[model samples]
Target: MPKIIEYPKGNFKNSLDLAEAVSSLGGSCDRESCAHKMGLKMSGAFGTKIGTTAKYELITTEKGKLQITELYKLIKNAYNDVERKKFETEAFLKPEVFNKLYDRFKGSELPVGMLSKLLIREYDVEEKQAVPVSKYFIDGLQYLNLLDGNNNLLDYNKSLEVEDDYAEIEDENDLPIKSNYSSPYLPEKPTAQILHIENKNNTTNRVEAETTDFIVHIMGPGIDSQIVIKEEEDLLIVDAMLKKVKKKLQ
Candidate 1:
């Protein structure tokens, strides 16, 4: 029998709210205390919420203690809304099933009608659980603004195109997919050395590149701009620019 992989039973927002509650308790606490903090009774429902948060990689559980994760800390302490959305995308894709689904349909439209069936057949989700899993996945993508009105995923190329009303937002979901497009803004001498930071399970937790000359695309609800990094000292200037966007999350 195939091992049934776990998934988040709750929607992304619910999972995030639970993570916020856990954070309010100084990042870690007993499960019951965390539940109580969220005004939820200690029942199967509450357990499911905790499990969902853990599946999102926003929180983790160990020996009856619930703790906010490093990913969650990064999300909570993000430099700006853009960076926060990037981290949130990482958290959303952390689940095995969601990651698999994303890999299959990232640059295309999601088959809404076939989502449940696909989950059951491809991801080993149970018959009864497939519907909710599919629902949660779509809801999560919508929450992250990664899905369009037609249910098409916003790919990296599509994300670069600016709309009239709203600015362009880089598709954080596409960060893992390396691009070979050489920009004239990038220096010609040194090639960017990409680095994959993997966790203990050998899964890539983050991606970083070791190059002083790279492009930084900043975009949000009403902002769209790009900065070229030609000099090492330019990083300090960019850091200062990002700091202007930093604000406490209410």
Candidate 2:
């Protein structure tokens, strides 16, 4: 007859280490207080399946404090099982939920920024457009493993909803704007004669003129006509003329 070896009982210190490891693996101990109730429920289910009635025992040895390898194994197994089940459930149901939300809000007065924020926080997503979220939702539904793919509790879509768009806006406002307009146009190096031209007429009149030297600066596909003069003589002449003009205009 073969002797059946009993599973090692976890001690107090071992239990503590196990719990810490589980938490470090992104498992929450908040239970009812957790914002994501599904995660809590899954964790509880795991604990129940593992026969962990009370907290696992923490064990200490002469060498030093030791983590409960057995407890960790049990909890890790439970976590993996619960994650798999949660992924399957979410995958099957998330598409319909996403579709309903998309249809309800598409082209509505609802602010896309706010809507997107809500979706990210609630669902864990990060798409700029609706179609991508919809597609992701479907993909999440098809693959259960993707739910906990990146040590993330929620899907990428849900993360997007939680992201702080205001922070991004504030970051954008910190950048400076550069312009390319100059008084005189010239080639590189110093020169004596600096010639400058001023358009007295409005932009519409200038655009209509056939003989106008339509100088265009290409920024991507768009064109900007704000001439930037860079010749040394032209710069000096423009500077001198501007000083005189300022006196006369004032």
Candidate 3:
């Protein structure tokens, strides 16, 4: 049997922040260059983070330096919001860590503590390490609107639920292929996932009162845009944390 590949979470604040920073870079650089551009110190922790990014192929190392992958550049150069999100979805879902986990659990709700234990048991990682890795996995996936407000998984096909105006959201019953690759951050499954958000405001004309709907194109393992409209006040992060329409369990 293939061993499950494992990697530490990179020190990019969060995966999305790291992607944003890399996009800001001129498409290629080293660890030092990456740190400098992000205005972060190139300490041991930073080095580990850089390594993590490379592990995922978001950035590659050449002659002991780093360079952005062509896929990521496509995302950075995307002409529109939905297209950019599609690239990001492809990048993240490329990792076996995301696919296997999503396959095993689908999009069911899971808390950090429980997930940590699963990691430890499945990969035989140290309990101390498993907890943090679990957190990283959950935190990173949030960038794609894969998780709900209470940590429940909203969807797994990497399908972002946009407004009804867009194509209908994908069905979670469509499961992904379980990853059998033993390499960390390697692509082992199909592409297609999600990232979405909805926002609202308060105004006299009731501008803020109306619900704001977003439409995104999920990349690898892609699916139709899933929709999840939120109340205006609940949309504190309307633009950031999008929305999800979970399949009602029987």
Candidate 4:
């Protein structure tokens, strides 16, 4: 099985920039009364009058639009870096799997749609095939690989050394001869491991909050998928598939 590669975490600047951009659109906080004002502020003086009475009032103010604009720019920049790192990490960790896929169909004369279906099937076994022929071809390739080796030659099997329990049979002359039976050795199957990583520190809290709020404003609701595929098992599958392909090609 191939070794798993660790992906680097994304930079924070990109994520922050993305958040700022979304927040600057205004109507975000929904302060209708302060609409006329670009910014909002409140101040009051504490004083005692008569029987310890205090007066309070609301004050409205405006902040520079450039501040919001600059914040958005910073967040957008951060967001780009975050997304770039995500894609980079995904590709780096799954290079073998992606390479196998490219080698299997990239230069082939197969149609785009057919190639897509084949890819989908290879990656996602649950995908249904309209014509079972493709499945048969894939299965055949797998079987062929199982029987062959790197040089495309059948691997010599070792006989089992276990003691036989069957009774010996004698010929008419009462002479005993060994039976011509043997068992083939099977190669050990590869093992797989799955690992999961969770960020408990809320390291990207600001980015998450901003993104969530942005999505809610744009889509009327926020939805997030926390699933991340970062593990050794993926690399094992990639190695297995590559070996199978190599055996077939040879």
The numbered model that scores best in lDDT is 1
lDDT of each: 0.68, 0.33, 0.52, 0.27
Ranking by lDDT: 1, 3, 2, 4
Instruction: Estimate the TM-score for candidate 4.
Output: 0.16
What local lDDT does model 2 show for residue 57? 26
lDDT of 1: 0.68
Candidate 4: tens digits of C-alpha lDDT, residues 1-250: 3332221122222223323332554413323222223333322211011001100001111241212233233423444333433332222223243334434543233333474365444544223432342333333223323122222212211210211111121111111121122223222422222111124344442234433221111010121212111332223233333333343456
Model 3 ranges with Cα > 4 A deviation: 11-25, 156-158, 161-250
Q: Show model 4 residue runs off by greater than 4 Å.
A: 1-97, 107-110, 120-124, 128-250
Kindly list the per-residue Cα lDDT of model 2 for residues 1-250, writing each as its tens digit.
Answer: 2221221122222233345543453543332322132344535553432222122222122232233344343444544334434333332332333434434543323333354455545444444543444444434333433223222223423322222121232221121122222221222333332112234333542333453332222121111233233332233233333333343455
Question: What local lDDT score does residue 200 receive in model 4, on the 0 to 100 scale?
Answer: 38
Which has the better TM-score: candidate 2, or candidate 3?
Answer: 3
Candidate 2, lDDT over the whole model:
0.33
Candidate with the larger lDDT of 1 and 4: 1
In angstroms, how far off is 163's CA in candidate 1?
11
Estimate the Cα RMSD of every predicted model relative to the unseen true structure: 15.1, 23.1, 13.3, 30.3
Return the lDDT, model 3, position 54. 65
